[model samples]
Target: MRFKEWDDYIDCLLRQVKFRPDHDDIRAEYEEHLEDLYGELVSCGVPEDEAAKDAVRSMGDPVEAGKLLNSVHNAFLGWLERLLRWAMALLIVLSVIPLLSVALAGGESLIGMAGGYRDTQEHGALVYSVPVGESVALDNHTISFDEVRLYEDGVFELRYRDRLHLFDRAVKWSYDLGFSEVRDGNGNTAKGGSGSGGGSFLSRHQQYFEGFSPDIRKLVIERRGSEYAYKGRDFRIEIDLSGAKEAAGL
Candidate 1:
């Protein structure tokens, strides 16, 4: 027997198998076993042709082996197993998509928050900036005051963020910083400023007011009510502008 003869024997055996998909794997396994047996017989002093013949004989009748393998490799079972493997892979990919989307959205929001002031400052010259880290708790939400900026164009910018308490129940709500009124130390009230705010968990707000007296010593932000359905309690944020005024030589 030769190598060609061994291949012919395997082809004959697989002809009886019903599951066509398992033919390659079964062929490789049978070939490996035959090679090992043939090598052993030749190492024991048997001729190459005789070793191949003995190896094939030791494996038994091809028809009988094929019938046994056909029973084990049922066509239905092989296809079902392949389908299940594919389904499992698809499920894993589907599960990860939403998580990746949420992560990307959150990353973009943080980048915006970090660079928001710099983008706003590009429009005009920055005259003075004062960091006034303050917080006011309303119900389960806490509003934080980050800083105040004055531009040479008479625009007063207030930057803040609103966040929910860590252990608070999840609820859908939004606060508009534009709803708050700005008052100077001289009792002059300035209302209706343009602003923009957005975020997923921690919301960022930027309110821009104009025409402030450069000699102003202090400023106050008073919020009486909200335009949204969830009207929060009244609150006040008093910002000392003395530092800003002095820095700007006022």
Candidate 2:
């Protein structure tokens, strides 16, 4: 190879060395060194081919040099990766602090709110009330009453100590869209067995409430324009009152 040919090859090799940190300056210096070597070879009467081979031999392997350069490049990349991870960790902690504070300030203790019911019932002009504690073992289930009357057709409220349950099953099922036709004892629709369905879930739910009465520990009744309070479990719904005549009948 002539001096010009060898210079062209070195230029191409330098262009391919992407990982070289100071490629331009190093390539220029290498070119000058090759020029000096070519002058020496020409003065010594050495052929161009032999001088080119000698220059290439003196320069160590390009592949090994490239590997070392790549190692340096990857080390920089690794440092950048560690810096990014630490920054991300700091950002995540900063984001979670406000959420934790909000949760604590809400006073929404799961264990504290889980124990009894303050129930209210109203029938026409009468209102019956009770306070029942949850069973010893905490069961997080909502049991509802199908025919629970609020003033017979008025206002009802449900309360729970450890969990929520249903006081008015009719409204609950209605809201839940659990409507089904009223079925008779023979598993057929009632009244001439026409089977024409009505959008009332209570007709089917009554069966589940049968023989399943909770012990009413205390009772408060507002009936016939008067209020009556009772202690202990009692199935008897007494109707004694002294007020407006309508309350008397209530």
Candidate 3:
């Protein structure tokens, strides 16, 4: 719509703008320019209303002008604006993907977080035993590798009676240790999951892992060369699972 006054003309030109720290400055500059135009037209014997109309009309389409002004004031310009917007959007997508993945993984992630809920649920009941019955020394600490379960796929558990607070952090995942690894009979490393280590000073420290290679003759658990070295030795154990299927009667 055409505007008849300077205030109306400036408002029309900036109606679509939502962002601007410079809106007042821009409006004042436009008002001064239009006032000069109106004065020149009146001096030439033009009517007041006609002069105002002519001045506002000469500024072009209000909507388009507003768009131009918004673009000029927005921080990023042209292709740089487009690129940065896309990059920020992509970062949000990448971030949400993990949370979505965990959510989509059913209640397993939640159970994992509740830290031993698997042992209480029906799925945990399906967790049959594959005996490891081995131990390794770290400082004065003796970490005993215990049972394994084939149904849960690479899950293993261990406890240390001699020392609590085994690692710097009370609980840590297998990936936290450079030395800790789950290897199948063929010597290929198996996928490891969240394992934890934390307990009271007087209490035994228990930790579990979610990782197992199916139908393997035996699996080796070792954490020898990692940064969490124990008296210059790497912690290691072996689970003879050649008869795991028969043992669990699966």
Candidate 4:
């Protein structure tokens, strides 16, 4: 559906600006935007011609807008945003390739990467799972330890199975579940494994740490006293890595 009024505004604007690929894109976007606004106004008891004029007016100073866009589209900055998007999308697809290939080949892939009931391999990693005897009570929910895993590259992860109904079930590991000798990370990814209604609750926490020596035998993850005062006593997770020394091929 072509609006004569909209086409006129775009034609007038384009005349003031040099013809370029960017201008075409901008013109198309503006056309859609104006059409939407016009449709909305018509739905709300506004005449089509009046709506078209009002929409163009709202954009303000057609000549100035065209000049600004002409400058923007010419510079490297014009295509930078789109270039970055394509780059990021390509990177994501590349990263998923390894996982997808392994899965399709029937090799041991996401079978254990996710909190699945698979045997943890100890060849390259001190991979194994163990249950926790204690549980931490936070507000209305009690977080019980489901399992803990130590990967090949010293990548440590904790899986919590039981989670009560709640919107935000974030645990401040530094304050809530403190690892006295471990270090905290700035940006981390936590994917809820095996939850109700697909993935409402249940979480897996990955953390990095320091303070390891050649003789260091175990990685102890302990929580500092809770500040919420919900759970009275403090509990800890001790991952025995007698075979961990060999994981690094030391």
- lDDT string for model 2 (117-234, tens) is 2223322443433333322111222223222222333233222122223233333222111112222232332221111111221111111111111222222221122243222222
For candidate 1, what is the lDDT? 0.78
Pick by lDDT: 3 or 4, better one: 3
Ranking by TM-score: 1, 3, 4, 2
Compute the lDDT of residue 57 as modeled in candidate 2. 56
Misplaced by over 4 Å in model 1 are 1-5, 12-17, 61-77, 84-116, 119-128, 134-145, 151-154, 160-176, 179-205, 211-228, 231-250
Residues 1-250, model 4: lDDT tens digits: 6767778888777766664556778888889888887788889988877887887777777788778777756646656777898999999999898767634533332232354434434325554444445476655456566555555544555544434434454652322243442322222222222221112233333333322332444555444555765346555555555665466455
Which candidate, 1 or 2, would have the higher lDDT against the true structure?
A: 1
Which tens-of-lDDT digit does each residue in 1-250 have in candidate 3? 2244767768887775655546787888888888888889889999988998888888888889888888777744545666788999999999898767645543443343344323423234444566556666554345555556654533544433333233455353222332246676676765433334333222233345444445667767777564654436766667776766776676
- lDDT order, best first, reads 1, 3, 4, 2
Q: Give Cα-based local distance difference scores for all models.
A: 0.78, 0.38, 0.59, 0.55
Between which residue pairs do clashes occur in model 1?
none
lDDT score, candidate 1, position 206: 74
Over 4 Å off, model 3: 1-127, 152-162, 165-180, 195-198, 202-212, 226-231
**Candidate 2: Cα lDDT at 156:** 30
